[model samples]
Target: MSEAPHRDVLITGIGLVSSLGEGLDQHWAALKADGGPRPVVDRERFAPYPVHPLVQLDFDRQIPKRGDQRQMEAWQRIGTYAAGMALDNAGIKDRTDILSRTDMIVAAGGGERDIAVDSALLTDILAASDPGRLINERLSSDLRPTLFLAQLPNLLAGNISIVHKVTGSSRTFMGEESAGIDAVRTAHARVASGQSEICLVGGSYNAERLDMLLLFELGNYLWREDWLPVWQRLSRGGGLVTGSMGAFLVLESPAHAAQRGATPVARLDGVRAGRCRRGPGEATAIARRQFDELVSGLTGGERLAVFSGATGAQPATSEEQVFLTSLRHADNHIPIRAVGSIIGHGLEAQFPALVALAALAVSHGMLFAPLDDSGCEADGSAPIDRVLVTQWGHWRGEGMALVAPAG
Candidate 1:
């Protein structure tokens, strides 16, 4: 028996909603504006810690039903909306024949908590004789049944299914940034290996929540005081400022896309994901290995740029900086842009968002301006035919993907 022939995976559609705003044109305009883009941050709301907040969206445009909107939490709504946009962008929103077979791979984190219920429980538990019992009692009585169901990470996938009708085999991943890396990897591999024809893959993060802020602050992973570019944050102990973003991509096999007459945004040449002990030089080594494998397959001399998902979280960010610097020293002086500096870190959604931006750049035939004054980012006026997107998770996981213009 002969093995199935491999196919090329092409990114046909992209739906992105972040601090810069929604859709490809809006984000592209913001990043390519004459004076360079200004970070759309809210420092007073979250206080000390600044965040890139999502722009106002009319839910009715994507999610029409009021009942559907009422049932979903913010993250679910964002994901579902983005998924719909991806389908629409791919010109298959109402094409039941195509959507019926579109697979879905979502990278998500646990849902937002009910802060009021949590506050009351904490207050009461502190005064109760049996704190454990008090907590259980409050959880059972104070929390609504629907709220618990809403908090499940898979609900994002469920909502996407219900709202957008992408009801093919659905899988959801939950490990922070790595989850995102694996989601895109799985989607690309499935399409390229003849396992699936098309896939809807991505995730969303709501960084404006109090619970999320408190959670990361507890880990001492948040920067205090005002905002700074991701690269500059390293000078003063690095920290991550989470953002509210939802990113989704419609990936299709080249044959399938051509058969349907769908245009390609970019070619997803390769994706490599790995993890290692946080020992010195370990993360950089993993990234170097991944970078080598991804680029080894490419025919040389393409003008390249990098879209780095370097969350301003210490040690990891510093290590990634080292790896990027080494790329420059190795005579591969690709211009680098740490995307987290603008949109802020979206955790599970971060990788997909960066990939979307890379696709936009390659499709446009140019790279956006440098995001920071930190000498790490240099201006690149040359045409970019290929882009390398890197994601080094704040705590663990390292991954990279090669995106190039579709022939």
Candidate 2:
């Protein structure tokens, strides 16, 4: 017997929600406007710490039942809704046959904690003479057992399956930025190797919460005081502004897409994900290697563009900029857009978001204007035939993906 013929993977649909707004049209309009209202940041609610909040969404459109919406946490709701959008965009939302065969891969983090119960328990413990006893009582009586299950990372995948009829094999990855990168890599490899024909891959992050804000501030990673575009934040303190975002894409083998008459936004050439030990300039070293591999047969010049997912976290962000500058100086002086500057960092959702944006840019045959002004990202207009999306985690991972016009 011969090995199955290799397949070409294409990004056929996208569902993205962020501070820039919901859907590709809104985000495209904002980016295409060039320097319109910059990314919407909420500096008041979280005080000095800035966050990119989610746009107001009528949940009924995708998540029809109030009961379903009520049980899921914000992140799960966001992800499930985005998956619905992707299915709809691919013209398969109601196609039971395709929906049954679609494999789902999600990148997610542990579920949100119950803030009210936590606060009450802490407050009561402070007033009680027997603090330990009081805590034990509260643990058994106040906390619901299901709360633990609610926080499981896999719940996002479960919710997506229940809300939408994606009944195929399901898998969820959990390591922040690295998780998102690996999820896309798996989806692309599966489609390319003929292991799977259609796959939905992506994740979500909710940044407008007190618990997450406190969590990041513990590491001094939250941008304080005011909002600066990601590239400009280093001058102030160099911290990341988390965003509420949900991004999902429908990937299908070229043959599968053609059979269904589905239009592809772009072709997924390859995805490379790896981690650096953060040893002296290792992020850039890894990125340089991955960049070289990703841009293999592509003509270098203005026709190629780079979309960066650099979180404003120090050292890493600065290091990535250095790599981009190096690429530019090396005659790959293509247009660069640090998307985090516009929609804020989405953690596990960030890389998928970049892939979605890159596909849209290639599909339109144009590059969006620069979101940076520190002379780091240059501005230009070009009919982009290829795009390289990159991300360096605040602490460890570095990844890249190459996308091109679908032939």
Candidate 3:
């Protein structure tokens, strides 16, 4: 860490892909539109469990080589593609001189599961008189040894390095939503502290697979049948609808970006992440502390807003609401956009996605229409100056980030 003076961290570029669409322009257009098409969501695809499916993309645009795209699973391809988009957005994709120095920090979950093997094993287990032996038989006979290796979480970063030529120091973190929060947090800290000049950080998730839905279904954490606004899902046990998305960000020191003639989208003021046991008021308390600390740095109210990574899961989402309501009581009146209402839950990628959306809102000098007319989310009128991004994971982890206009 540098002691002389920490550099200001700027969001020099952002690359986001979600059910909304690919690229920032598509997302902005979809969000700001008044009453045309609603957010992209599919109800009948997985039946009972409605999901926000990703749009069909031409992978060759970002990932030029057919071989590179073939080696990766859906999540890896999505991440590699988005990473290239970030580099291009920063105007450094072709500048190998700068890319060789760009560090990368990725937050990722496990690779996609093999549903066929799982289903066969389950079927054998149900029919066999000796269930344990049947399970072992399927594990030995049906599963390929190489299958697990292909799903390694770090492969996302590895694929990015191979496909995009970003060869600086690389790091990967895995822990669901907190992984995302800390990925951005660490990248900002590195830039601000002079440990690194520029960093590419984010993650991706493929939620369309039955494996992910089944994983959550086992835990009773999946929304059923009809799709509803995140705020309105409480009536049906408050579960989440999965969305496939890849979110990557280019973070650079203010001096570094200016030196390279790169335009910054917004300034990252602060980020704080923590964990709270599922106790009564633990998550809310930690969240409010982070919110107050981050908001203290803003110069004025200036239509400040919060883009929340609420998973529509119980306890965490409700506690986050408590924190927001507390802010309102203090006259902060910072409106919130439950981003999951639009993009669904991307788990490990949720926090970064919200941060991306927050930066976009501030850069555009306006926030989109209220996601729901419910009293919780208020419409945005004035241009945004400072925005807060909040994340409370389904099981644990509470995080916050402040993205403000680049001076």
Candidate 4:
């Protein structure tokens, strides 16, 4: 049997929603201006856990008003909004043509509980001892659909399909912290093999939830006030780049898009996934090797900027720092942009969205400033090329950059 011909996938449209703002215009402008996470006026929103900066998004504009809004969860809403915006930007009004040729792949971290809670409220009206608050505060047009099933992990992708009436193949995969890379890898293989012409791939997290914050703290993965000791030991504080939410891109073959008269925005180069070197003091060393292999397939050092998976934890951040240090040593001196700081650690869903944001920056010549923290500084030994302005007591470690040779 002969193997299918490989094709070059191109990104033609981009849509993004984050605390920084909604739509690519807002996000791209903010990125160039170096915007940080939005202010959380409702600090009690995630009470009982140490406070962390979160990426805030405007939900009102993203959710549809009529039928579409009636059928999805917040996470689904995020994905749908982004996908629609991206399609629109790509000059695709009716997705039928693209839908017939593409598949949907999603990377999700959380929000199933929100669906359950909403369902419980709808079905058990009598169980609502506090109907006053529920009626006044929690009502949504989206919650009215009894037939809608948004609790499933795949609901984000499913909702997109339903809205677009995309009867093609759709699948959602779960990959703990690696889901972002995993989703891209899945899409890359399918597109490369001619199984799909386009892939709407991204992830989203309801990180503002109190429950998630508590869970992260329980795992000792959160950065709270007590991390002051850890911060003190650091030679360089990182930048904050919060703006969590979902991002979607219209990814299709360059040939197919050209055949359809669509302009390309960026190339969906390639993605690699595997455990980086990290254990005890060797965290940085492992990360360096891992990232090196990640870009190894690209020939001739194509000026590459990395969107690192920095979780703001001791091991994760330190390993990332080592990776950046290695890049500097190789004379790459690539800039590092951290998104998790602003968006909080989104776990599974964070990477896909961050990838979209970084890709936008790479193709557009913008570098979002990290949230500023006077006390926080980059690791002196690491040789970071740029600093994202970060807020005080906040740490930023995830990085996204463009591919460019030493300037």
Top model number, lDDT: 1
Model 3 pairs in collision: 48-225
Per-residue lDDT of candidate 2, residues 1-407 (tens digit): 01222677899989999988889999889888845537788889889888899999988999999999998989989999988988888888978799899999999987787889889888988889999888777778887744664357798898888888899989999999999999999988889898899999999999888888888889888888688888898887699989999999999998899999999888988889889689887877788778777786675353778899999888788878888988777764577888998899899999999999999888898877777679877765757788899988888888899888887
Q: List TM-scores for all candidates, in order.
A: 0.96, 0.96, 0.94, 0.72
- Candidate ranking under TM-score, highest first, comes to 1, 2, 3, 4
| Clash count list over all predictions | 0, 0, 1, 32
lDDT winner, 1 or 2: 1
Model 2, residue 347: C-alpha shift (Å): 0.5
* Candidate 1 structure, TM-score to reference: 0.96
Better of 3 and 4 by TM-score: 3
lDDT of 4 by residue, 101-189 (tens): 66777776544455466566777667788886665555554353343333466777777776655556777776555665567667766
Off by over 4 Å in 4: 1-5, 34-44, 47-71, 114-151, 226-244, 276-290, 294-302, 369-407
RMSD list, candidates in order: 2.5, 2.6, 2.4, 7.8
lDDT of each: 0.89, 0.86, 0.85, 0.54
CA shift at 262, candidate 1, in angstroms? 0.4
C-alpha positional error of residue 1 in candidate 4 after TM-score superposition, expressed in Å: 23
**Model 1 misplacement above 4 A:** 1-5, 144-151
Residue 83 in model 3: lDDT: 86
- Per-residue C-alpha lDDT of model 3 across residues 1-407, encoded as one tens digit per residue: 11222878899888889999999999999988876227688888798988998978999999989998888989999998888888999999978899899999999998777788877777877878999777666667777645574358889999999888999999999989989988988888888889999999999999989987888999889988687888878766798999999999999998889898999998888888888787998887788778768776566545688888888888677777777866766654577788999889998888888889888888888888888766788766767777889888999898888888887
Which residue runs of candidate 2 sit more than 4 Å off their true CA positions?
Answer: 1-5, 146-151, 300-302
TM-score of predicted model 4?
0.72
